[model samples]
Target: MVFVTAGALDGPLLTATLRLRADHAPPGTRSRVFAVGAGLEITAATSGTALAGAAAGLPAPVLLLAVAASHAVAGLLHPVLRGTARSPAALSEATSASRRVQ
Candidate 1:
């Protein structure tokens, strides 16, 4: 049930965020945007798990509400940050280029 809800919410949010990031971020910054987004995702997942674990003593309803609230916050924030789209050639060039370093 949790996976189902998470997938339903996260799938579209991830798609839109990636599309916007590709559309709004500057050429020189796209890689950095991707890197930062990836890092945040990892951190969020880790933090959420730890928080949930630490809250294990709470009632199931309260824990669920907390999880939902966190997801809501993430959903609300996603659209406020946007990125620029790379042109086909630029994307191709980026793909052929060596990985970008932070």
Candidate 2:
């Protein structure tokens, strides 16, 4: 399973993502430290998206702002969707029990 969020604006942008896998691990290792972290940041007079965002196919500046405002409102509702999501809680117990029998 995975989760992701991203936001962009005039000054800066923020993004985050996470993924969990239910794969096998070495014997006796109750838990594993998979790729625990990642990050990136860049600054310059211009950024790649700047040109693409201004190109013909893209929406005009005003339209873009309106779209952003709409998403800003929808973003507030994001938690409602994720609140019902589940993680691998009971599966860990089942994994350990099955390992014991093996």
Candidate 3:
């Protein structure tokens, strides 16, 4: 049931992430950008699965805590990283740079 719920939630998140990536990718390099993004996602998932398999001997509580901590860290970092990328100056510079490239 938990796995099913997680999978259901993951679908929309993945869709939105891919859409966001596609929207921001430079015009001529959209395909390349998507390829790279997909490659990275695959690599991350594979690495995570491998890590979990290696850690299978750990206590369930420990494993669950580790997962929770990782999610907490990511949630905290998201705002900081996003703010940096979406700042007014950063956005203006990116826009001008993309315009210049065209």
Per-candidate TM vs. native?
0.56, 0.29, 0.74
List, residue by residue over 1-102, the lDDT tens digit for candidate 2: 123323234224322222232233323442443322221223222554575566547557866886698799889878987686544554567766898999
Show where candidate 3 strays beyond 4 Å: 1-7, 86-102
Q: How accurate is candidate 1 locally (lDDT)?
A: 0.80
Instruction: Choose 2 or 3, whichever is better by lDDT.
Output: 3
Residue pairs with clashing backbones, model 2: none
RMSD over all Cα atoms, model 1: 7.6
Residues 1-102 of candidate 1 have per-residue lDDT tens digits of 999998899989999989977875667779998999889989989998898788989999997888799899988877665245456677756755745542
Deviating ranges (above 4 Å) for candidate 2? 1-59, 90-102
Winning model by TM-score: 3
Model 1 stretches with alpha carbons more than 4 Å out: 61-102
lDDT of each: 0.80, 0.50, 0.86
RMSD of each: 7.6, 10.6, 3.1
RMSD of 2: 10.6
- Candidate 3 residue-wise lDDT, 1-100, digit = tens: 9999999999999999988887677566789889999999999999999998999999999999999999999999999898767644565578779889
